[model samples]
Target: MFVFWLVQLISKAIYLYTVLLVIYALLSWFPGGYQSSFGRFLAKICEPYLGLFDHLNLSFGPVNFNIAFAIIVLQLASQALVLILNRIAFMF
Candidate 1:
């Protein structure tokens, strides 16, 4: 029971973080948006995770493809974690 709740909490946190990442990516499109304090904070929180995909250098002529890929990956990971937690809870 406790484990289930804990997993739920963690899952929610991850989902929220993913949303923040999305916001960060969107803000990047505006000039000087990333220079704001809030933007910097978002970057600090999101960069490490997004940085993973950055290594792939997934880009076209101008678009940074990795940002989309990273967001998708984060969503998939959050879903998978929740699914696994539910499965474990069911087994117990």
Candidate 2:
């Protein structure tokens, strides 16, 4: 039961991170948006994770799809974590 609770907690944390990423991306639209204090705070929180996909150049003309890969990776990681936790719980 504790493991299941942990699973849910971790899942929500991942989702919250994803939301933060989205917000950070949206903030990039305005001139000097990311330069604002709030945006900088978000950047500090989001950049480390997002930097993992920096090598990917998935640009379509004006739009950059780099963060999409980051989000997908996060989702995959969350699913994998849930599977692992369930397996561990089953061992008990």
Candidate 3:
């Protein structure tokens, strides 16, 4: 039961993080968006994780494509974690 609750908490946290990522991506469309205090704070929390895919260089002619790739990766990871957590919860 405790493990189940822990899984639920972690899942909620991941969902919130995903939402933040979406907001961060949207904010990037505005001029000097990241220069704002709130934008910087979001970058501080999100950039490192998103940076992991930076080396992939998944971009087009002039566009940097990390945000979309990062979102997809994060969604896949969340689903995988939930599956593993559910399996563990079922065993006990």
Candidate 4:
């Protein structure tokens, strides 16, 4: 039961991260920039994770590479969620 709760918590965290990543990507499409209310909202949600790649000098030649990296990380999280569910099923 404790293991089940742990997996549930992890799944929620992963889902939140994935939602934030999607919001950030959508915000990137606006030409007005991240200063807008919606942009700021997304920035507030995404910055901590996105900031990690900011210092790396990573780029896709003017495109925001950070979003791509975040999506990849989220993808990994998704795979992890599937694996965890599979384990829980097997355990029962």
CA-RMSD of model 2? 1.1
Using all chains and alpha carbons, the TM-scores for the candidates as numbered come to 0.87, 0.92, 0.90, 0.67
lDDT of 4 by residue, 1-92 (tens): 77667777777887787887787787667787677987888778788877877876657688767678767877796777868776977788
Q: Please, what is the whole-model Cα lDDT of each candidate in the order they appear?
A: 0.85, 0.92, 0.89, 0.76
Residue 38 displacement in candidate 1 (angstroms)? 1.0
- Model 3, 1-92: lDDT tens digits are 88788888988998899899889988979999999999999999999999899899988987888988898888898889889988988988
Name the TM-score of candidate 4: 0.67
| The candidate that achieves the highest lDDT relative to the unseen native structure | 2
lDDT of 4 at 39: 80
Instruction: Give the residue spans of candidate 4 off by over 4 A.
Output: 74-92
lDDT tens per residue, model 2, 5-47: 9999999999999999899989978999998999999999999
On the 0 to 100 scale, the lDDT of residue 29 in model 2 is 84
lDDT of 1: 0.85
Better of 1 and 3 by TM-score: 3
